[model samples]
Target: MDPELLTIVVMNVMNTTRLVLHYFMSCETENDSVVPALLAAMETNNSRLLLAFTEQLHAVDRRYWARETSTEWWDRIVMHVWDDEQWLQNFRMRKSTFLELCAELAPALRRKDTRMRAALTVEKRVAIAVWKLATPDCYRSVAKQFGVGKSTVGAVVMQVCRAINRLLLRRTVTLGNVQEIIDGFEAMGFPNCGGAIDGTHIPILAPDHLAREYINRKGYFSMVLQALVDHRGRFTDINAGRSGKVHDAHIFQNTGLYRKLHSGTFFPDQKIPMGDVEMPIVILGDPAYPLLPWLMKPYTGKLDSSKERFNNRLSRCRMTVERAFGRLKGRWRCLFGRLDLDEENIPMVIAACCILHNICEVKGEKFPQEWSAEVERLAADFEQPDTRAIRGAQCVAIRIREALKEHFDHDSQ
Candidate 1:
């Protein structure tokens, strides 16, 4: 075997062992309101039982892999249970309701003999277990964090995503805030602006030989996350596909969002006509997108026409999408780097964040001050130009500036 290959194998084995050990013996820290409730279901002397289970983990490791490592490894595991006693006491969720819900969904959820079975009572325990996995760490890390086996960590993630996806099936569009988002754009100098359209890169390690295909000029392998925002910087549509190597135009053509303007009924038995009535759904783009009639790009040429003025203001409004992506990836530094999962799981997790972001925005929830500040700070970096990657990047930049010559270009009319 190649020396590099041998090194990787050895490193993987060492990391695996450390993560598994971490799972068993990590000391607890503070829990948010949710973690405590998750811990509440444990019976008396649960810690003592947990410690004994850690001991049994050694036996299971020996029997399964015949690689007798260390019981001392178990001593290294950490738990955060002591951080919030009040939270545990006050946490409320009907254990019966959860069990009944679980019974309806998957009866095999908590077989006492199963490794994934909860040490605590609240159904939120399972949900929390699922949540700890938002980071793309190995199951060993997640297992270590949640005090369960690696296999259990994997199962919890899959189950939670599928379960949540199904339960949240009736997600209506957030057009309720559409007017507010549009209002934000109007204030920012873009009127009647529907949303900003842009793409983001999510880093993930290469999975196989074809992994090279996913790598981009950014010096990392990534998947492009494309989003369409409403006038107020609220997300209206998101599609995660196409590796970083694919151009923005290719992604736009494939997305099929334009079809919505052409098809579908509005109310009972009222069939909408199919004639090409150009109801303008402004998809504000930089020159990276095509100059189609419906989708507007910034103007780069001399400001002589109504189109030039329109592009100018359109560019300014569309900027919010770029800033939003900057805020999201910069605040979540984990997203700025590589993810651990295969490509398939990557999209699911990315989709979950997009969904959660809209949900949180709708709920008016905010992250800590530090993250908020980071978002504002790193935002300028996103607007910086790349002269090399895009041949017409400079010309497009010119077009955007020209397009912004006036707000809405009504002077031409």
Candidate 2:
């Protein structure tokens, strides 16, 4: 037995003995008829306390006596044997990129070694988290592969995910070089376009509270991940944790992105002349989003050749966001299956995945062809939400869409 644990047990026993002695002395001065009842009550209380203490000591003893698990798989196979390709296959990032992330997250995830056990190394902790996110394995499977306790795997995942969100999310998933994004979109035939926005459902275990709210139109429990991506299919901003039943427009309107765009603060003042109207920078969305001066969704109802051409162009550009999401879930296969984490922690994990996606993309990591097929299959499973266009469209927004249609028409000629 550990000296500290032995000392603690001895102290508890002494305190209980002293307490019993005091009770007996007090009961001696009480009525003779009441003495038996008092002793009975004290005996019951002491038995309960002793049972609880005995259980706790057994638990501590089991923990102390358990031999440390061998980490041969992680120590030898992963550390010494794997190459860059293997790392990318398993972790979805190259060894160099993984090291960079470990360094970035070290401050938050690093733990001190205790008397009983050595703390997990920073690299190992990060690897455990990334593997959990990148693959569909449950905690038990992950623990077995990594040679750690199942609970340790879960704790390490949350710790690393929270660290990634706290340290990297804002910096990695932001709109960078706005003019460059606009230029990229213009080259793709959408003038003055800043980004493409869309939403997808991330499947999750049904939460205990308000479980029905998470069921989407498709009849599965999920949370909405609304994302805005630049021309290169990199996420610029993401809004997650919204109930799956919510509309895309509703989620969009509630985001800080909406506020920034509405207040004319999201984009730069750059504009291009389309006949008499000066077109402000805009983001392209599908018909699910409302048409605004800053947001251009496709025209609904019957359309002529010119309007059709505009919608086609917009759809092509908006595919950036869709493909971004496809790649996101494709790389992080855990997102394809229902996440088994607590509802509160799911958002952090999602954000961490996005941050990692950006890193992999920016680093020019090659996405495997096999993952693309999985993404397509995942896409086919979900039905599109019913489009509910907001009523009372602004005249300026109408003019902007019309002007863009005419521009496409003239450009085709």
Candidate 3:
């Protein structure tokens, strides 16, 4: 044989012999007495012995593969367990609400013409969508548990999400009931307060392009979800998908709410009577937002006793938005972790979640126990002021805050 071929034969025999020896040594009854002869044979470079051993080892370690089992259990779980309240706790919604949601989404999510094999039903698809939001599992793990492919899970989630956004978002997330909002605020000791405004960062995977633009001051890639929440912890309006690096003020200015408020068409022009002073009915926010005639923020710098009282009242009321956010994120744990999706799709998903949150609130569903910690964490991540307000806006904001301070002080006396 050629010298190269001979060397190869010797190496193969040695490897085979090592494997057999190791396997035998692993057996509790096997003895170590055959080691001396095996070592001597390997030192002699026995090509013949190696050639014989190679054929024996080939069949010994033959690989076998099994096909993946179909995920028929997903249907069983949805139709069966999803209807049982005791077992339905896993789905994060009451059985009645789940069925109602399914019925509402059935028309939009119905698929009679699809060619995909073993296509998921609208009910299952909606369940999968809500399941993704309610749990921290990745697509693969969720798919495996649901007995579907990962791609299918992702597709179902997006399909149901878009359907929810299209069918329920506008109808459910409207600020049309301004009187209710005003009343709700008044009940919270903030008379004339229309809504509590605030911005939160929803963590996302940085885009391949404009990655830096998505990074906020906190050193994470996120998208800003600026919301106007009612006193009942429901989101009345939301403007999401802004670059995280932008300031809360900039994000607010870009929203339709800002445009409408600036144009003097969004809210009524009538002034709210506070003692002798007349102040505009406005939304409340932190100092990170601009202090418009229709928006209020707490005192930024030095404070005397009255200013301190004003800040405390504003903070106490402003915390409504924080609590709303906490409940939102707590109920939907998907928001707790970074979303591994394209940036464009994120806002729709968020909107869908907000819509569902409102539905739950209307239906009187409580936040899950698992979500309390996340809600508390989200409540703590308040936005700091990003820019110095223009001098005129600053002066106007100060006067409004001072007026409110007097109102609160007078009420205490």
Candidate 4:
């Protein structure tokens, strides 16, 4: 085993234990217990560890208090403090010490002084919630492990999403970032492939009026999650619009994602002025969406060549998005299990996962991003080849799909 990797593992466990003790601290009792636990965990060559870990623990606590002045006001080192209405909120023991630390960076996060400057500090509360929900684990298990209630977990996820929107979204993603992502795919040999746009389906329990409209061909109630990903497969845009029953093409048209094609703009023009060019952004399809000047689809060929192989390769690259979607759905069972979230909150959850999936792509999480947000997001069914049917009967749909596919296939040679 690699020594560094092993050290990391041991450190992670030690950190967890240390955080737990903060919540359950008795300075005298903990002082008594610390040396023995360190000695118990020591290897034969490690007599110095008892003193070493204790010093490390104290240093960590000092740093914690240095950053959060209210750490000293808590009953235990693990106590949580919040400020609202400029008054001291009750000091409560954090069920999960690690989570509290993870969220303590925001200015208004926790303090004994507690005169509330903000009702919700988006950074500490919402951002961490988003991180937790995107990760794979049972909420109850998460609560038990982290020491928070399930409802708090849910609330935190929502808050994290809000924090991100207010803070990180613009910092990390730019129209320039979108263009750079497109360039990466072009270098991989997919020309004019600004990005691939597709819709996903997420299952939902019955809604009041939209019950029948939400029944998809998959024979379930679902909502459509439309997304835009570049050739390199990073998600630049996503739209969780319409019910599952709405066709992919309609979801595109109705949600105004398709409007970009007609309006001569294929990407978000939010705030910063983007040049008005009919930038070509292609969508890989199995025959469902309408063909527009900005879109393209694969051409079936009589014989396979480098060009054919190239198309196959391009398809393979674009598949990164679909793979991401599959992993996302698989990690969160609550998403697959009767999601009765308020209608507005659904997209926020999907967006949070998409952001993390993009981060994980630094390691290239398998094949590609998934387009199955409606059926199964971040889905990777290794046994099944990537192929699916398309349905486009609207005059808009039929003309758009056929035209774009022909244009792209012909250009490939």
- Residue-level lDDT tens digits of model 2 in 1-26: 66466658756875876687677767
**Residue range with the least summed lDDT across 10 consecutive positions in model 4:** 85-94
lDDT of each: 0.52, 0.88, 0.78, 0.51
- Residue 148: error of model 2 in Å? 0.7
Model 2 / residue 393 / CA error / Å: 1.7
TM-score of 3: 0.78
lDDT of 4 by residue, 263-301 (tens): 857554322111322334555543455444455554443
lDDT of model 1, residue 32: 47
User: Candidate 2 regions off by >4 Å?
Assistant: 1-68, 380-387
Tens digits of per-residue lDDT for model 1 on 1-413? 34444446555655665565455445565644544444453332355554655565554524244333232322232122322332221211123322444443353333354574334322434444334433335567756554556675666665654554454322622344545665677687764445777887777788675877786666567788888876545567777857877777677668756455324211112211112222233447776776543455665556566665565567677878876675455323446446666677777666655654554455444444655576556444333222122224344334433443433454444
Our model 2 lands, by Cα RMSD against the true structure, at 8.2
Count residue pairs with overlapping backbones in model 2: 0
lDDT of 3 by residue, 42-127 (tens): 55655566565565565464355443755566656556654555434556678788889999999988877466455567777887
TM-score each candidate: 0.58, 0.84, 0.78, 0.54
Query: Top model by lDDT, which number?
Result: 2
Best by TM-score: 2
